[model samples]
Target: MIRSGQRSWLGWLLSLGLVWFGSVTEATAQAVPQPHVKAELIAETTAIRPGTPVWVAIRLELEEHWHTYWRNPGDSGQPTSVKWTLPPGFTADDIQWPIPKRIEVSGLVGYGYETEALHLVRITPPADLPVGKPVTLAGKVKWLVCKEECIPGEAELKLVLPVTGDVPPPSTWTEAFSRARAQLPLATSEWKLGATVEGDAVVLLLSPPTPTEELTEASFFPFEELVIEGAEPQKLTRVKGGYVLRMTRSKVAENPPTRLAGVVVTPQGWRGAGTEPGLTVDVPVEPPTAFGDALTPTAGTTASKPSGGQPLGWMGLWLTLGGAFLGGLILNLMPCVLPVLSIKVLGFVEQSRAGRGQAWQHGLVFTAGVVLSFWALAGVLLALRAGGQQLGWGFQLQEPAFVAFLVAVLFVFGLVLFGVFEVGVGLTTVGGTAMNRAGLAGSFFTGVLATVVATPCTAPFMGSALGVALAQPTAIALLIFTALAIGMAAPYLVLAAAPQLLRFVPKPGPWMESFKQFMGFLLMGSVVWLLWVLGLEVGVDGLALMLGVIVLIGLGGWIWGRWGSYTYPALTRRIALATAGIIIVGSSVWGVSAIHQLPPVASAAATQPEAKSGSIRWEPFSPARVTELRRAGKPVFVDFTAAWCLSCKANERVALETAEVRAEIERRGIVMVKADWTNRDENITRALADFGRSGVPLYVFYPPNGNEPKVLPEVLTPGIVLEAFRETS
Candidate 1:
């Protein structure tokens, strides 16, 4: 209730009569002049209810692209703060802060806001205060707003509210207050969190109630200073069934704190979807321990070896092996491997007509080629990483020279397929040395080609294996790679060992020439894709030079086809071959040298905000829009289903289509949406991950009051949905 000392209706009438005199009652609470900003003090309540608390906020509306700081200003700025000058007998609590964005400018990293911000504080009044009179809440706010230049601004703001004995109406800022509250970090008990000091780094341990995604990025903004180097990246990785984020310690920290206090912000909310992205962290900091114990599996997850010196254990080893094998098998179907498919098929067909012994030999040679290629590639990658190159798989592809090389190789192969020219050996073993098409040498080279193309794709199930493999010693890493090679070559090995399977291949005839020519066109398609990749790597000028080099190669191929045949006289044929070699070599050398020197287009490209880095998905609802509404504390309902499923249609017609359920949804202020999964959608699959559901008919409800979102039963009825809607109230 409000202060009870008011003199009935007579005093209220007299105060209304003198409203124009000196009373400060007004619709808005604007501020003293501040350049580039509009500042004010506003209350969430229409009038102060004495003996109860009221939310008063310091509202700073900044100019476009300008920003103000958070509690910890990070590297080189001051945080926004306020000093209260309130009436006696009135008490004010400290400001309640919303999570801040990471701001980087001129190599300095800071935590702040970009636009309008509200610093909310709770004000509790005395019970004995007289009613029907206005109370002035004054605050002096000082802030540093920055773009390229930093400007400090100060303003004295006031909000006038009359003390009333009745329940007060919510002011216009009620919605804003709710939004600010939603932005505040949520304290959760779903994860058992702790911190450990690992040498110069701080390792945060989070044990979730269940397994979480393998996240690549996360931001931890510590409340305490000298805890972490804010500008450095916080590398997050999955361990067993939980997660760990290792961060660099600040140079100023002479000793570790008793506890690490901060907010862990992730767009795929720490407590999962439809919840606040900012999570409150206040866990004790302990001394370091080996991953074996610290990262022991809570359920099915365990701590990783982390480095090569330790063992990945039998369980980890098996998981890695299985994952690598599956990934390698999947690689054959990736775009990179498609160009060589037809050639391999033709070789297999040719082998079907050959002796079984020859086919077996060719298979063995091909397997050797693939295995050795992987060995060489993996060794180089491991060595570079050991030497601190900070590289990952496919690191070579980032080089323009490498891209150009791939383009040229694919183009030449395309020419071979199109009968532009012929090599003594093909990439696959076929009719042997007699046919001048493919030989044992060809089989080995084809395996090498397969390995090279397969590097570009990181297929499903490969992540856990490859990620762990690279962290191991050279020997262990190679073992994993060997498994991958064997998996990739498994199908070919099976065919080679059992020539009976090749009986399906037709005998060589007119169709053979047509088929070879068709395969050549397929290779050309691969060349086109490589050209596109080259254009991206090198700008337009570089692309033009590379195309010129390709044209020269094509000409050289034509020259060789014209005169290198035995039908030509010896001296003329020899000269033609030498000229073709010289042109091909010279043009390739010139083109690659020119392209590698060009600056990457990405350097000038605009940067996306760090928040959008994660692979967060929402099917029917836009991820950004849902995040926006969630941040504003709005209620939302999503039905993840497929039209092909009869149950979804039945539920829609019987429950959702009914006026009663529809009215309840609208009454709850819920934004209802549906995602059709009739056809496979990767986005829908990812959204389903939000609820830990793999398939459709999933229902989720986000309440307006900021409670953890609820996942309803897969089978929904009007009663269940109506009950879910009641949560919004």
Candidate 2:
């Protein structure tokens, strides 16, 4: 209805109105507000050079009282993440997070960035990129922001920069990028970090390259989940090199971590102003040795030995010495030593018929042998300890080779007792012999053998006395060992001194031969026990080797006994004996080498807490496991035992394996941990030292509330174990 010129004007106006409407809609969509955070993509430079790297940041600004999580979130919450979309020649590296603060919400703790944060990323452009072109770096950023409640938000952010051959000028975001870079964790090499699991805490040792200022506050943000209790306070102790931070282990940390990777925050005074915020470290966790300050002996004390309890006064020292003597006297009655002592007793009976002087002289020489052996053992123990070796009583038996040697010795002694060969023929008195001189030498050798066999038994009262001796000065320790030796020889010495006591002894006759044969069986029993111990140490293949060696030894013994005693051509006899010796020596060496080559026996079955076939189950002991369980608020019962320890075996068979004890343990949910000292386990040795005792049969009970563990007696009864549970529960 309008004119042509008017119609053209109307069409132009209509088109203009439509374009304005479209612009408004696009602006509204782009300006939409996130739930609790605002995010933007920023660049440090307006342009990027070809073949050069440039920094880009995802800036997250949270609302008042709101926060974004750090990489480790801590206990709960999700950290900020970004997915990049870059040009073909451009590559984006991982996000670099700034130092975060610890935030507590209710009872939970979290690590996060409050107020604002810039996560920096490095973008590298290919050298072949055309300098005239522009490139767009885009990111889809997502974050969890929290106040009283958490809200998730996402943003699509992009930055366009022109590629140039020259260095770009700084943009408006330069200051922000600099600030973010300042807050980032320093390189790991700047500081030395070490971690150890001690009791219920993870001790972190931090040593800075330069002397650091006195630290007033510090915190750790673990990169791994469930390693430490985020809510628990960390204990910091100033040490020689730097500081040791003791953080409580989380209940969920079942195994000790191989490395502690995380960020640590300290005050401005700690490492100077520039490095005030944080340090990123990945430290290898090492087993604690006696070298650290924590293990160093107290002022005025020698070596690293801890005071087992209160210092022993003169009266207490004498009492401990008396206890040592009584323990040694009881050692004579222990099954491990009794068989050999019975042989010595027979020797005494034979000497008694001769005269008092002869018997007394033999007893003195035997006593001298025992005393000298004890001195040697004490010296070795002290020397090794001084040299930083964790050794205890009966430690020699832990070696497979030593155990094999003992087995061979016992087998040969058994053959002698069975009268396969006379005592002086090819054994103890091979070279020369006045009959009396041969007898004296035999007595001395018997004492030495008895001392060697007695090592595996921990008689009553021996634990406490030996513990005190090892913890004391070298001189005092030797004195205690000497007292033990004297007590062992006391009964025999007394009988020899007073010949009147011989009247009660049965006279030697045909019964003597039968008795000697019976003693041989007992010696064979000991050999069987040693073989069983070896089996536990080295697994099935090692057991086969030992059995084969036993067969070879028996064949050599028979050949030597049959031929060596009778008259024969000298050359033929020498050749025959040499052949026998070669067989025995070769077999023994091969067996020992094979045993060493075998892998360590797995104790998986022994490490569970459930009963199997009506027997109590136990988990193999580990120091870290004990600490982890204790921190989890569980009760723990540790049995420190060795296969060679007769007391340990007896207790296992009598009390621990009983149905009543097993049921009680299950009911109480006790964590039964067995520390097998059958091999050279430094962990077990350290644990023994912690208890002020140096030997096995140590029973330590940790209550549910994490109190100091209660030590049960070396010998346990079902009632005693149950009663202990009741008290702890």
Candidate 3:
């Protein structure tokens, strides 16, 4: 994921104009002492028949050690772009880039060639053009040239060609144009395509010997960025001796057509292919598990229709509502909600002797809090999605700052419930403290907090339901969210209406204090888990700071609890409060800043390999690299897993690590690749969603022939995994 920090307009303007322009130096046209950069056009002939395809190429000759950009100029460099001015009825297509080498220098990455490079464009002249007439094609080319530092350059290049009845075949540049065309990806017109939708992702199976084996060297560049992240390609694994590319729906995806368009790159060049598997969500699972069963097809299965587009009309809307209701009901059972529920239960018991109206009021207020929170969340998601931000459920976890803040908040609550802090005069239990002031509001806030914590654990049916809801119209999305809200609030609403349920609670006495304390421990446990997650994202240093903040906040709460008592002096109380405020503010700032500064972890431990092949060290999936290896006849196996994705971890521990699976793979001499999507990788996300999988724990086994692969089930067993390798072998 690329982080876009703040930048001023002036900085951007300079980057586009002077800074980028001034860096150019003619490489061949000028024999200057300074660095050289030259541009020229190569064409098959000066004259061609109108309506006949002509190869017009743009060539860039860079001096030693200097480079020009590829289509995907990685992290820092700018790609070479051209603007063509042609006569009426003349059209020019985009320039095709040759395979680029990965260049990393000074912690910057850019795809480019260090030496000579040629980009080809197909030109077609109008059939009505006058015979024997010449037309000049002019264009400005902009490119970023770099070694250690990047320099942007532009050059005006032109090509004069005649529109004649009979085209002249003899040309000095014909050989060069031929070579450039030869470099492009194998013509796909001869190859057959098969694909399947596993979940949110689409898995394309390319048959026969693809011109090249280096699938990693190839990029599946979807035409639309909003439909796919062009920068990141899901690693293509060689399964059953063939290739399987994992692709996803873009975070900012639109309602795409039946055919999803994209370009596939090999080491030699790029070829275009489109997959039109019918995409649809597995309908919501009711108590009786009513829904469309996931379309899991065997090998060589052809998709009858496209897999992704707008969601189901009204049917999806109702399903979403049903899911929301279920989610709401499940919220009460969540670990985060349990503590608050206990406190509410205790409060109800105390209010019973007073009046049922008050008890009912508290329940209503709690339900209101949960529903309101859900609505607010829906608003945020809708607003950000509308603003074109790539966001998902549990987006909060992506920010270490938010996670740290939550950790501190939970710590304080846990401490308070454990009797480390007291809120009301002569009150020990959390309910007593809240009841002393405004019980209903307190219950409401508790409900909101529960919802916030519950975002991470997307219940079983929630992902498919939510995914469908997200793609629907705003009204439908809202209805689904409301349904979930109703589901979550159902149990609480029932308890509120039936005041007699308060009798189920034990009398509020000494034992009640012990129960609250135990519940406090649970809350603290949750805090610890959140802190641990933060540590994984940022580092140990960040976690240490978070722990310190929790301790300081606890001390503050403890000191504040003693303020009205005869325990501490006025001056000491004031000092404690001031110290607590400072620590809280300081820690929050420090934690946020630390997270922002944290660089991505690039170590193997941090990066999970996509396919694990033999003992050969598994590398991160690259389209170009995969293509190269496959060209070399090396089989590839891709394992898409994640740290936070529960199913993935389970599969790794149980099935993947099994000796039988490993032995079978080793015996087959397959290359193992693990694509780690612990963090949000646009490539992986696109790949997953492309395969029709909303999430991870995906396993695709590639055999030696480069045919279709065998996809394993979500829950992998040793036997299943071993059999996959054996069958592929």
Candidate 4:
């Protein structure tokens, strides 16, 4: 958001040095300050031991809300660095950092400290006899702290301590060092970690030696840039025996790194009692598999010949058809589909007085609409996958533009439900297209809307069925999609075919109007959720513009209802109609322009709420760690999930998040790792293929004594989970 004119001089000044040696004005034996922060040099020991390393530090205490950066400043900004000016035979080690926090501003993420940050360094002295002699450790410290604007700061500091043969009492800052040490990440062989390339993602695999305390915060700060996309989402997914954090690959990074290093920080204690908050990560990265080779079936995979060109046995095809059908049947109940379907069905209720033939007509048209829409989406999926895009089910909603369009669509519908405007001969559809026909147009559009919104969820049978469908020939995939469509549309078809069901429906009267308005409020609630999702994808600016578009849509609806409704003169109605069109279309164009095609800027992942009391804390999945744990006689459970997957979220709430489940897992000493696939993840996609699934919620459990990993059911319950563990035992 910084304009070209703003902070041009700051960039020039940054060129001066990483350790910007500002002219000194010492307060107490050498400490300096300016605008927003105070910088100083401090020591850990009152007296230094000769022939050994002594601890010294550069401390910066900033004014409230202004802050500096970590070694890796993330998407934007420079790190606080120091230039040592020590006497001969003196050596300074690299700064030993305490864990830095995740800082977010204007949709950018950075790893840094707030309120205060103390960076420690070791100053080593050569072996020599110099008793009772004072030595000064001179250094220049430079940093950049930012709020609305960034300010460059520095100070030359000299810490004088007496050299002695005997150990000296701890300095005044002993307690401070102790506190910061608790936050520092230490190397641990207890964890077995590695990394792999999954198309545009770099997944860091982390495995703990044993079950860990609940990890309320799991943010990874890469030691170096170009190894991973720092600004994009680092999805933490659970897998059998370990955890995987899927990071978007940096666009500028063309080659895979031999070693990707960083720190994984947990504020509320990632590990169990009496453990450090920060854990070091230095792992080797795996190269990517060739594209267009997905689901080719590896040695360990169950499905050997699953591709679009090859035909499955008739039995397998039938099973796939059945599964697809059932998946669609369940899809109607998903969170995304209900709002649209609810209003559509209410329209059917209003048609109770209409003849059964008319009702039957509406039903058939609605079913046709659903079936055709499915076919279209299936075609797009097939063509794209054929063209070598690693997309899976529910891919349509992944686009921020599509989600924004849905928000606009739903907002206008809510307005209509509130009687803002009704689509008649005078005005157009909420999408801004004229609807010349009657009830049939409403029915068909309802079916289409249902299909569009249903793309963000994956039902039980849908994942595997979709896997098989996409791997089959184009015709076969279309047929499978048809089955799914019919399944979803079955209930409406049945109701329309049997007018007797209408008898159960309430009589349409004043109450129906109130109910319709109430459904409007519910649709508005859905709009709120969609808006939040959009904001995460496009940032606050994009979100604000989208809100403005929604406002325009509301205005258009009012204008149409006020002046273009049946009560207005023809010429007046025409002018209002044209004016509404301009407002809606213009605002929509303006809003969409705000969508940034570039990857997310320097913004950390939003702070997730701490796990509820008695909940299990899961770790990052590391295959090597899982193997080690198994060898040592331990069990691991992993859940492959995504942010957009409603079924995944539902499972977490219903089966996994309960206190009983946590207790049982704890009793069994099971380690849990989550492999999140909310975004496009090639590794997760391939992992799904290894299990013959194309989507989540996949569950795999690794029990002790080298038992084979047990793949649990897509849907879960406490008894079911307990029984799985028992069987493995």
Candidate 5:
């Protein structure tokens, strides 16, 4: 059945089929498609000459709507990386990243390239021999591609090129390389740029080489994390010398940076002839100046002075100082300070009965006490701020230990006012012999106590003045604080100076005792409020510790009042005093330590509140959440509040918690965010600074269109809140 010629032809056909099948299988194995992206190593030219530098790129083609990250992947994401396997004498430089587009996903901001990107690197070969030899360039590239979700991919890419003595022919990828080159950021001396920090924003001033149109669309991509809040919309406005871009500073950027390095991208038509559109900038960050100085000098024209120089202009400095004085005068009427001032008033009444000269001396001593306390507080605040702390006025009230101590002190004051013991014999006197040194010391201590208790109240004009004072140079800041001290003491000083004013006061009588007892009740009420604030800060455990301390304090006061002042034996009295002092000191120490050691409240537990009808449920505020809501085109309302701030509590009860406001907010579908600053929250502090405020009770309204947030007044009424929604709508 097998003829010789036929059998040979059949064998040859079978061998041909086997060869073709093997060739096809090898080709398929060499070209496997990677998930989410296609990656390859490409050269700009088909051939390279010896000693000449050649541009090689790792090109990534992503699926639709997918992207890969830049070197600095903003809020989140990892950048694409590559490792090359080069020939013996070849060297490769770092990969150059092109300008990245700002990509926002679920409120998180990222910098990356969509669809496709070319990461270029330059390679150089040694001048020695092998001109006719072909070289293989290989690299292992890894990248993260993300759409709604993220997928990681890796591929080994290889390219072959011939080495020659003549100039190489351009490859088909030449156009791709040219386009990538155009996207690269240019660094040149022609463009003048500068940056300065103002309040919580970093102001960037850009002066192009030639005149250009008002840049409506521009963005700055920082090289480091936590230098700027990437999600917060940047405000760009045209100034005299250049454009000023005001971007919110990151909460994590505690220390002011000396230099700011980033990429600045403008619209396509912004570039002048022969100038690059995008700039890679590394400019020095100028130190912050006073609000007054910022208004006078044009940014980017001249450099700001160093630290020691005065930053505030004359007009702003005087106006802020005047406001501080007026605010301090008004602080006397706040509920928190009223009880303490009552004791000072009683002392003034007693001194006035003695003589006008003695009353005036008491007033001067009290003024000295207030001024010294304010100066010390100002110094500490400045030092802490310089050391990179995001602190503001009333920061001390946020501390549970401090609040507890104030409560204990106020409680003891209440006991004194109740006449449980004689003023001079058992405790510091308020109405002792007016001309004695002891009486003067009591007057000074009263002034100090008043200053300490007044921290939680922010009177009208006080917030803006304190904010400006804190933002200025140290000397100017101290001057403003001094003015506040004088204003607080002025009322008492004038009353003492004009003895004729005392005619209006009733003569000393039995009714004064009832009034003193009533003031004691007021002080006790303040103590209760402080206890509530402590509970909010450290939870149930801290409340228990504070209550136990109060009980111990009461026991100690009883011991001192009963036996410590007088007894048959001097040794018995001394023992009783010692025991009382030990109990008071030990209980205070234990309470403070226990409160400080309490664990932080879980964020989820703190944010969740019981559901209620006709009430707006508030979500805890975070930078990411704000960004997300804004990106979703939803309007947002933010309440920056602290439990220690009486004004904050009043506003919440009177305005925010009202049914009318809630109904309106719900009808508008507004996203309500509560930034609780009851404790030390740096994020909330930074947020307050963004509105040029230094304390709590800040209300911010963000429109659906992502425009600048509208900051409401410190005092909010239901009508005021409803009007804001209507205007924005």
Candidate 6:
């Protein structure tokens, strides 16, 4: 284990602060707080002839287990990123990613590898090459690396190469460099890469198949970001010797570039990397008609704007409101909302019995709170956007502080549900039994609380609505916001307006206590989820502190609960309150200080490969290796999943455990590897991201070379699980 030594007292103080302030919110937050990546430029060719391409690469080596992300970092984690500064005449081509193995950890999936992976770039020598001089290439590299907690790392890397004739690179460093170059993805063998000028957009075509052409599983990774949404790639169908990949180009470009870069992975475990050759109408190249009918540019012209703008209209307003409203309503059901909702619900039930008039009044106040909170959120988002920030809705949760606050709120609410605390008389008036449980204030607050939780989930109607609303004028934006408030508050308002609805609810009795307790259990589960999220954000140490905080709270509660037994009730109450308050404050302070006491932020490194490290041996996923083992006749089970997706968790719980699946693996000496994709891991992300996916649920089985590896469906069944393993065996 690497131990952090205390050097500067100030640094140590900051480390403590990190520990204390780090919360569950920080745990699963996607972006790293401080990027820690370092980059250097290495070139084999000092100078090259004009019109000829030379090999130049920006080699980034992450510290230890911390890994930079790939262009497509599976479902989670930021991709390792770079922006190159080149001279006017010179331009750099896309960096090529080596084939990556899938890594699975906990229940989440990620795409990255331990140790090192290099990104190679092909540079086109300037046509007007200046002799005897070198040009400088500079780049700013920023990346997020995560082992458990993620930190952002960045560096400025520069390199200068001398100009020379078209002689082959020197043999001294040539072999090593050539080997690295060969490791890059190869273009399709059977498929000739080329672009066709369709009516409006240019369609790139892939021709020629590998030696083995029966493609049961295959996908492509576009060279450019934003060109592809990283959605699942369309299926590959065999046509004679080659297979055609049906994919849509990005909405940015009108005509295809001179070259398109991509990676193609087949069942053979073969990765092909090459540029899609351009189609010259003069060469009699056949235009592809099968790839989904050529996309028609919106304006009937091929020119695509860098920033795609939406068509103006009221539809945008409607979309925003509809999304917000639906999102708000759905928030009532999120785990994070349950504890707060329970408190509001119970208070309402009590208030209803007291009087209908008071209940209605309470409801309106709560509604105001909910609407105001949403508007506040909208204002913040708008402000950020106006300031040129790149963010989307739900960005607040990306902060560890926000997550910590939510976690605390939920924990306290959970305690309240368990009867550890209660709102005093002033606050109680709104929801007490004397007022009747559905007090207007309590109900309204519930609506507001629901909206807060609703921020996380984008409901069915929310996407298009929010998308449209976000693109609208400021006046229109507020109008949509109002519509959303109306939608979200409608259900609560209806219940408040119709006291008859109260009559429909069965009279509360002993079941009330049991229900409250059940909700408490649900709240506890939410805490567990939050803890996991926290683990992802700040590492395990922060989680330990959180656990400590919970324990401290529990102790304080215990003290408070028993304090009323003293003869002097007033004095006892005062002492108990003081003691509890002190404990809460002390714990919070200590926790915050402790967290911040660690080291200066460093990016998280990818865990070392199990096989090489000898920690826990997991064979890398390779077609040759799988074939060799199978011919020796062993079962091979490849888990192609990542760490950020939730569906991957459920499948692991329900499907991986069935007796049959375990028996096959153990009995047949099956090779199993769990690809983890939680943080920004380049290798694994490139692997999965290359396949046109951002999340997990991928499983593959390789029997022998004769029989191609079977691609399992996203959702797993007991039979599906058993059958795949059996085939491999």
In candidate 2, what are the lDDT values of residues 369-468, reduced to their tens digit?
7888888877988899766677898877877777788787778778777866544622332222232776777777777777777866677788778877
Candidate 6 per-residue C-alpha lDDT over 1-729 given as tens digits, one digit per residue, 9 for 90 to 100: 434564566566654443333222122222222444455566554345566776766555556766656666654567766798876677788777665433333433445545555677777767788754556666776766777777776766666555544452332234646656655555434445554443433344444445442223444544445443343234333332234444455455554444545555442433332332211111122355533322211100111111112233344344556666775565454333543555566655654454466556655766776678778777787676545444444555444445445566567556656767554333323223454443344455555556665554333354334544554556666666666666666666666666566775557677766676666767676667766655665678777777898788777766766673345479888898789777766776666566545332212222444433212244554334443565565556666543223345556657875567666666666676555444333334333422322234456665534355565765577788887766544
Q: Is candidate 3 or candidate 6 better by TM-score?
A: 3
Off by over 4 Å in 6: 1-198, 202-311, 323-341, 351-354, 425-431, 436-448, 474-485, 508-514, 564-569, 589-729
* Residue 596 shift from truth in candidate 6, angstroms: 6.8
RMSD of 2: 21.8
Could you arrange the candidates by lDDT from highest to lowest? 5, 2, 4, 1, 3, 6
Worst lDDT window (10 residues) for model 6? 297-306
Model 2 clash number? 3
Ordered by TM-score, highest first, the candidates read 5, 2, 4, 3, 1, 6
Clashes of 6: 99
* Cα lDDT, all candidates: 0.70, 0.74, 0.59, 0.70, 0.74, 0.52
lDDT score, candidate 5, position 673: 85
Per-residue C-alpha lDDT of model 1 across residues 1-729, encoded as one tens digit per residue: 535455556657654544432234646465655888889888886787678888888888988988999898888788888888888899989888899987777767788888888888998999887877788888888999899999999988888888777667677778999999989888875777888887788888877776533332357888877788876656554454366777888889778777899988765566665568788899888766634455421111112334212335566688888878887777676555776787788778877877778778878888898999889888887787555344455555556787788778777777777776666655434333442325878888889887886654455565456666775667788889888888788888889889899888887777877887888888787777666666655567777888899999999889988888889899998998999888877888878888878876531111221212221122344444555566577777777654323345556667776778866765666776565443334444444533333334566777777665677764568898888788545
**TM-score for candidate 1:** 0.47
* TM-scores of all candidate predictions against the true structure: 0.47, 0.57, 0.50, 0.55, 0.59, 0.44
Which regions of candidate 4 fall more than 4 Å away from where they truly are?
A: 1-309, 425-436, 596-614, 620-634
> Whose TM-score is higher: candidate 1's or candidate 2's?
2
Instruction: Please report the candidate that would top TM-score against the real structure.
Output: 5
Off by over 4 Å in 1: 1-309, 426-438, 603-729
lDDT for predicted candidate 4 compared with the true structure: 0.70
Give per-residue CA lDDT, model 4, range 1-729, as digits (tens): 777766786555543321121111112345577678887888776666778888877888889999899999987888999999987788999998888876667767777889888998988887883765667788888889998689888888887666666665466677888887888897874666777776777766666667542221256788897777655645544454355566777888777667778987654354554678678988776653422222121211233223112355577799989999899888877665765755665655654645677668878888998999888888887898665566677677666777777887788778877888776521112222222356577778778888877755767787778877776778888988898999989988888888777787676567866777787888898788788767766678777878888988889888988898768889999999899878877777666655635243211112332344677676644344544566567787878776556667778888988878888898898887766565455555656655666667788877775656788877788787888888997
Kindly provide the TM-score of model 3 when superposed on the true structure, using C-alpha atoms.
Answer: 0.50
The TM-score measured for candidate 5 stands at 0.59
**Ranking 2 against 4 by TM-score, winner:** 2
